[model samples]
Target: MTRRTVVADTRSFRSDIQGLRALAVGLVILAHAGFRTASGGFIGVDVFFVISGFLIIGLLLREAGESGRISILDFYARRARRVIPAATIVLVATAVASAYVLPLVRGAEVIKDSVWAAFFAANIRFSLVETDYFSQGEPPSPVQHYWSLSVEEQFYIVIPLLLLAVAVVVRRRAGEAAEADRVRVLRRTVFVVLAAVTLSSLAWSIHVTATSPTGAYFSTAARAWELGIGGLAATLVWGRAPRLGRWATEAVLAVGLALIAFATLRFDAQTAVPGSAALVPVLGSALMLAAGSTTGASSTYLFRLFSIAPARVVGDWSYSLYLWHFPVLRLCEEYWEEPRLSKPHLAVALVLIFALSAASYHLVEQPFRKGVRWRPRLRAITLYPVSLAMVVVTAVGAHAWVDGQIAALEDNPGIAVSDYGRDGLSKDPTVALVEASVLAAQDDRPVPGGLEPALGSVRESVAPLGDCDYRTGTRKLCAFGDPDAERTIALMGDSHARHWSPAIDAIGREHGYRVYVFVYSGCPAITFTRLTDGGRPWTECADFKEWALGQVRELHPDLVVLANNAYQSAAMKKRQVGALRDQLELLRPLAGKVAMIGDSPKLPKAPGTCISERDVDLGDCLQEPETGPTRIQGQFRQTVEDLGMTWVDARRWFCAEDRCPAVIGNVVPLRDREHVTVEYSTLLADPIAAALGIAEG
Candidate 1:
């Protein structure tokens, strides 16, 4: 292959830009490390978006100006060199680490995520999965941070072609005109496009953020305006020299820094983001960029400080730092079982992050960008195919492994369902505890075949079919057990209610009852409105619940079972209790017997991981259950009694003496933190049936 020198463009280079990069990465690091003061530090991503727009668009404009046409191949090749190598390294490392440290189920998810990240489509994958960015209970994926990189990659793919199309249009319109006239037309076209994109996307951002903040955070359309703002600035100042005086430059820089600081300190998880709030950091970044472009501003003290070696060094490693930090933090939390890092732990994590980032930047990023000489075609042929092959192999292997485990478990049906031999209303916790101890004793023995991975296939065994689960405005009713039975039983609520499907289905099948399930993921069968974890009004959830209530009334089931994971706003005890009471009152008229099923005890982490990891002690995995009735349970129980209904506490099945064990009878009791594993749920059929005052068939 022939070599070509892609020399630096000194005129476009701004030393102070590196300082902005440092500041942005620093804020993100602080936020992820759990710094209370830097609540809005997530805004650093908006700043980076603006900087990326300014720099990339400026490069495109320069290429068009000097060469009289832009080279799409060359642009993409540069992008590949800058992004692919280090990212691939991180993805591979993360996959290997995840498989070793996390549970097989979670490890499988990370493997899939790594594959998506490798293709620069992680944002699409995350959006499809509906991964909530602000969820505290869910385990953080090692590659979750790749969503931002995916957005940037998607932008790079489109923007170049967009600019080239504009150039073609300008050339056609200015046929036989002077080169200067053609340039003027092109600049005007660029400005119009950027301004239009900025306004439209900003409007979309505000609307989406208000309606579905989780979706808004990941959607490219909602985020395009942040990048477009930078593109607009670049277009307006194309081929021009800054004319700001020394004091004016200082004032602008000071104001820009102040705006960034204000956002970093003031914004928290509850604050609506990437909407109007994002303007603070976006405009601040643009102001700094404008100030940096001034020719003599380098002499100013503020500018000089920003251009210092340390800031530039940090800026150079910013991309790698951003990639490494979150994974390291997540791994630390996973291993140590401590989500909140102490000062000493935070310091150690930072040191490790910086070291990893520095090595990655020097070894993978810089060498690929500066030393490698492969043409775009060669790189695409070699790099993409290899990366794709790695992804396919890993994903296939993971799926097969999990599938094999599930198949093995299917062969041994007795392991999951054999322990439910008890009869009547038994209050003895030792019955379940003794059974679980017998199961635990089997943990040390090697079986004829390897042990079946229960947690990995927990959801698939009992979850309502995906297409039948009601979401959004749609209403879906899944019927289990004897459809023509005289006695009808209805299961209603969110995922917490759905987790009980296995148990209810077993009871219905055995006792000649038809079971109807009306459940969604986040929606509870309650009267009061609730917001999503991201702080957006859960309007779809409200609509679904209304539809479900109507279905329950129409069906008029002999018995109605109400359950939900009421963990949100634990501090707001009174509100939660009142909501449950209102819900019970509504359900009373719908069924002959209304029963309030108290939530199962929540574990600190997924029981599967705790059981899988040899280093984790079984005792540490157990959680101290509530000593007294939860406010919601107590209030709902009182209301049920007053209405002459029933209250069944399910915690007795999972917990003994106010302490919940992670595993029972070779079964991982909880799937995630709160939902019971399907195997465990199936075992609870007898107890649940007795709670509803049903006689055995």
Candidate 2:
């Protein structure tokens, strides 16, 4: 097995390739830049994959034709030099910024991802962490775009070695036409892999669009097919294929650009992934690629347009722009405490990215890749380790910086969690908070007659009847069943109400029970009779109950329901305790057969914290709080014992012992921020309904 070296050569990067790069990167830039015309602009990444496959394979073909060997190490090392340095710069830079920007609970997760990206597992991490793209108001991670780099890296790892093995076989088998035969085998392999991956990706993409939209959008399994399409384009470079004619190419590029423009303007993450809609731009790109300027036809208008010197410059610097813009825009958003990008912000981002990508491409990528002043040894051995070191060092430094920032935030001259209520607002929003656990167990504070002091409403103590529900916003109420139907069971509470509603609704549909949800975002099932600790009437809460009472009086539902966390956050003060008692007393007989839905065991403050820190299998976030209300269980029992209501304790649903898994019944226990995601809620529908006696009815 004598080793042969393929002398690296320069086949001019066709104008069409440059134009395609311009198109792909432009789509991505416009979409990411919040350009309204390029909503589905991410399809550009698929185009980039095709362009990469074409370029890399073209290089491989050129080598095989010239020298009988494919140098796997040389190919990989070149890739390392070109992609690693700039990427590391972006990663390190973003990691540092992330420390100051993201919340501490989330900051550490981003730092962990930074390490994963440095190691080339970003695609996998994102697949697990960020499957949903439609969740509103979620923050962006600093290294979000690295998912594409992961795809490219994963491709490189497999393609080079496969190409090498194919080359080896051609070398041994082909007596005279080894070069041609070798290229054929490699081409076939690439085509086959692309075809397979394309099919799988398309299938997964379809599944995600319909089933799990979030996971479908982010996971590599659902996205790899786009890159495979590019790989298909790459395999076509060597054949004497009939060109699409200049007119066709131009029209396709124009159409592709148009489709992309329309998609950006018309579509959003809510529109779905890669379904029939994505084809408009992806195929359009393929057409422009086929209609090269080399074919002198009038149809090549867009090709010629993209081939122009300035457009090519934009294409050249696109990578850096893609990298720098997001970070700059994000950092600015964080600094200003704004969430969306503004026009001025976009202008700044574009300018910064242009400068950075230009400097990086010329000073770093070009200088390192082109050996005008350097040798193979210099390209492979000199630059690669330095780039790796920079990535690792920067990542660690950013982690430390983030740690310091969080510490600083804790000691800030301003506000903290205890300072504000559950909402990310400056004021409290609860009518009355009763810590049953503190009242029952801890000597720290008293219960219903001696609870803490936090008011619910800010203004208009006696608010209007219409704008009332157990929540924060204008439409603060989320109803589960018929808003106006007879034979009703009012499901009143927070997410627990949400969880129980589906089951109740299903049972309602089956057993002639109309379930009406008078649920707040996180507030529990207690009545609204007391003032907030701040001494304001809990108007919003009281209004919600009043509205329910009105509905009850009007329709004469068989039962009026109430449910809540009964979360006994320890250490209450005075009036809130008495208020709690009054609240329960007021609510106990809202219906002829009133019920209090008990709390499931609340997980501890954090995931995996109790086990790792407490050295016990206390379940995820679910801990037997030594100081607080006994989660949802004991509170329901207490309220029933005191107020004489039917107690429906759902505690048995989660607890098996002193240990209960955060997720029970093979479902995610909580969706996000404490409420169960729809999946788990749907799963637990039956038990909640039966427990509420709706199933028997």
Candidate 3:
């Protein structure tokens, strides 16, 4: 193994370059911590990309003509020593901390992040993770910044080896011509990679801007061109420049610095394509490097600025600072339930980042880098597994614990469904698809208005003044719908069917009809069980629907009622109606009456909290409404109506004249993006009662 040492000519290295690194990384730190002024600070990463390209290319050129072997083991060993120690420490600690802090679903998400970080596949991870980037006012996980490191390291793995191979081939040919050919080959590779990367970035940026801008901002694919641009500079121009007059070089150097400063101040998160925006700093760095390496006077001013001692120190610590800042920011954000972070919080983040990075650099990074001083086998063997085990154990254990609770909730979806982020989302004013649909039902436009929200209802359907367990799959538990019960009525369906209950329950008490409801979460009162994942038959859903219908007939329900959102699609809606019809056909003979409460507006996409629901960041929802749900609702409505299901149209009911409020008349309409809030759902009681020919709830 060979150790690559800094040469005696190290003084020739520009100290201002390190300062430049400091400035870039500092911008990233501030930007991520939610400093509004640092909105353009994300361009710092682009600056770093250029710097990396310059430095790596310079290092490769230093050994370009050397005859001795380039040790792959040593190269990898240095990389591992520099990166794994601090990264693993953070990963292990963060994993354990997250197990306790995050909820079941969020905990699972963090574990996936941990696995990606451990393997240096964070770039790949970021590409797949669907989350907002600029609005990252939410707490980011510790592993989030690892994506940048992954890209650098992955590039390092290839670039050095490729350069080494080029050197070897050039030596075998043993001529200036052959060396030139070798350089050409290397340049060709760079050009090809750059072209591909740029094109891909352009395409992705356009797509994401049009479709999912937030995702595009965070995705590595959309950002790769920044790095590729630097790589192109390295291959095409870095070492081959001709000497220029000193004053001329200084002028060029000054211009470069001016460009970087200008870009730092002007570029921001919302800047689109960023293709040309990023070029300003990268090209600036290239010019500065060119001026210094050449005998040109144009670079003198820039070189002098980068040669300062303080600047060098900052550059030395820049990587460590970058690593430490995001976690500190995230901690504060999580603690505060922050949407917009305060300056004091950002300052605290900076303080924490500096303190930790300094401590970590001296204690962990320095010692490990001294490969000759330390016992390698001891450190590698003891540190590696312990660090890895910590991450794995913490992640897996936390996942298992969270999953167990989730599984329990899944098994008992009745009361447990209310526990799933309902309170958090409801208290927040953000509009999820469910909330949007609920509000849409209140619109002034003429909806085929039959149902309305029954506010201030305290009605219960369980009666004979006693409790009964109808939760069993096969057994039917009879509880009178009201203490003042007379004629029996039955309500049967999935959650959609269950939603009609609030009003029906009030109406049942008022009209002397005992409305007994048999309900399931997603397995609406439909007969079809074919809509399932994993290619498995859900015979249970089919049976539950069938048995509930049978019970309605045997119990001699006076008014047989069946209902669901008819908007599911003609084929799918027909299946749902067929199930409803089956129940109606059976009950009509026994009850001598039947009514199918119409379907509510359905959303196309599953409502997920687009923004943090707990923090109550309704600004984004109010600012840019999500259309996935409304579109799905249109499809669902068309399908259901096509099936000829007697349905109440909720489109006009939920919306205002044009804009629908997420919360209507002080009611939060959704638990998540899909399901209605129990409190909000209860509001529907009155409208249902009025439509059922009973007293207004």
Candidate 4:
């Protein structure tokens, strides 16, 4: 193997950049720790992206300038050694710890997440999960923060190949040219490529952020421009960095810091990320990096402040700190009932994070990083495969543990139908089964066997919408149950309405009514909608609704049923009521009849999660009718009834004696906190049929 040398020695370390790392990690930790003021602390990852691009690109350019070629093998070797060691340890540890701490269902999810994180595809996995409507309400994975690392690792791969491509093109164009000429051409070509990536990705990021913010948030394509901007800065500063005066440097640093501070303070989770808003922090980080690379900048007070010993120390441990803090905070938050940790709990988490990070830095990160330095052989690159294998083995072990638990539970005796009859709970079998389960729960009896969909897979038992359930404005007509029937029934709403599809389809089949289903994620079918949850114009949902309503009109459905989440917005109360009225009035002319399916009760804890716990009191999974959200839903029911449309009270299907159980008729009711599972919904077909006055076949 050919040997190559780095252009700069280790002493060229920029304490200012190190301080910047400290700042970035600090912001992330503060945000995760629930510091309300630092709601936009997520910009810290943007800072890190810029820093990584500047340092890595600058190093590669210097090596290319010196040797007339860049060594892809050596570059990858360093990256593998620097990142893979600490990352592997964290991934494996988080997976093992999750299996012990989380319930079987959630723990299995974490194990799968760990595998994705280990292979640096966690962002893709998470984006897929987020796009799945059923997984919307699931808790964040312990290794969720690895998504950023995955982005960086992906950058590491693409950048080297990109630079090599630039080198190849420069050599072909400037054949037999002097080394200086070749270097100059390489630099210019690299700059153009970097600029194009930055601009094109920025435009795409803005578009995606508007249309699909969750997808944009985790997308490498959307985030690449941030790193590209940093690369552009590095390209400009290489071999010809400005020698700015102290005052100029201070002014630049001050402006950069101000921009970052403004974004950190003013932005919140609702901010459209990696979009136009992201320019604030990305540019801020780029400016600071550019200024710091100048000759006289280090003498500036602002520079010295960032170069302080404490900041430098924090920066040294920043990588390990970033890796450990999220899982530590997430697992700790799991034990706490509140959405955000209390100050005392946060303090404890910080202590644990710092301690674990310090240990990881000294014990794992330092050893591997230094080992690579002492043994700079091409064989060190093999660490990539080895590290991945270690993580995979750990994930496999965790999966085995989860599968073992499922098999054991499967062997236990199941709750018999005889129990329902012996209990004499209700004449209706479904109602009776639910009542019996509730009684068994109240008595603190062991979790019975033969639970439908099983707790381990219950989270995934959502009503299957095939390809028709749109997450965006795009519409696809999906018909069920006697698609050729003359009498058509239109079922329309957001995911809340979707949960009732199984029962409605079953009823439609029995009654010879073709069901046309139109369900969009987070989109309420009611007219007069104006804004999305992020306060942007809800053009997509509005267009979808118009298109769906037009289709319903064309079909001339016999009955049009509209349903959505019943959880009331204190502010949108009047608007929601008015919208429903307008929706009914509009649909009255489009169909023979209009009906509204009342919202089902929302559980405090997700039934899938609640039932997974050892000896969990199933009664705790039940919700009362008078809960705030349920009361609000009831108010909406009254409004619907007052509008002279048949209102199917769906609460009656799930609730018995004013109490709604999470599991009914041996099936998990809600997949998450609100949407009912397909199995439970199927069991409600009889009640739904009676409610709609559709005589069974």
lDDT comparison, 2 vs 3, better candidate: 3
> By TM-score, who's the top model here?
4
Q: What is the lDDT of candidate 3?
A: 0.56
Q: How much lDDT does each candidate structure score?
A: 0.74, 0.54, 0.56, 0.79
| lDDT of each residue in 1-697, candidate 1, tens digit only | 0012111234544667787888999999888888889988989899999988887887787677655678887777777677777778788777877776666667777888888888888888888777787778676688998999988878777788988888777777788888777777788888898788789999999888877777788888888888888877776666765778888888998898899999998888887878888899999988887777775577777788887989988888898999999899988777666778777877888899999999998888878777746544467446666766776677677667655543453443222223445433243543455344334333432111222235555433445544566754445666787777988999888888988988888989989999988887766777766775446677777887787788888999999998877644643344656677788888888899888777876655665655455444455466665433454566666766787778777766776565666666456667776777677778788877877788531
By summed lDDT, the worst window of 10 consecutive residues in model 3 runs over 449-458
Maximum-lDDT candidate: 4
lDDT, residue 289, candidate 2: 49
lDDT of 4 by residue, 1-697 (tens): 0011111223266778888889999999998777889989989999999888778887888877666678998888778778888899999899998987887789988988888888899889989876421133466888888899998888778888888778776777888888778877888998998898889989999888787788888899999999889889888877665778889889999999999999999988778887999999999999998898787787999889998999988888999999999999988887775557888988898999999999998898878777645257466677778878998899889888877776665554444447646556676565567676666566555555577777777877878887676774447787897877788889988888898889889877877889988887677877767464456777788888888888988999988888887545554555776777788888889899888888877766677787776556566656665477676677667877897778888775567776666566467777777778888888888877777667531
3 against 4, candidate with superior lDDT:
4
lDDT of 2 by residue, 102-173 (tens): 544345556677777777777777766543443333456667777777777776776667656666666666
Question: Candidate 3 regions off by >4 Å?
Answer: 1-11, 102-104, 136-139, 175-225, 228-242, 296-301, 371-390, 397-697
Candidate 2 off by > 4 Å:
1-10, 65-68, 177-194, 239-245, 248-262, 275-277, 297-299, 371-388, 405-697
Order the candidate numbers by lDDT, best to worst.
Answer: 4, 1, 3, 2
List runs of model 1 lying over 4 Å from the truth: 1-10, 65-69, 103-105, 128-130, 333-338, 342-345, 375-377, 390-453, 458-462, 476-489, 505-516, 532-537, 568-572, 615-620, 626-631, 693-697
Q: Residue 472 CA error for candidate 4 (Å)?
A: 5.9
Q: How much is 443 displaced in model 2, in angstroms? A: 23
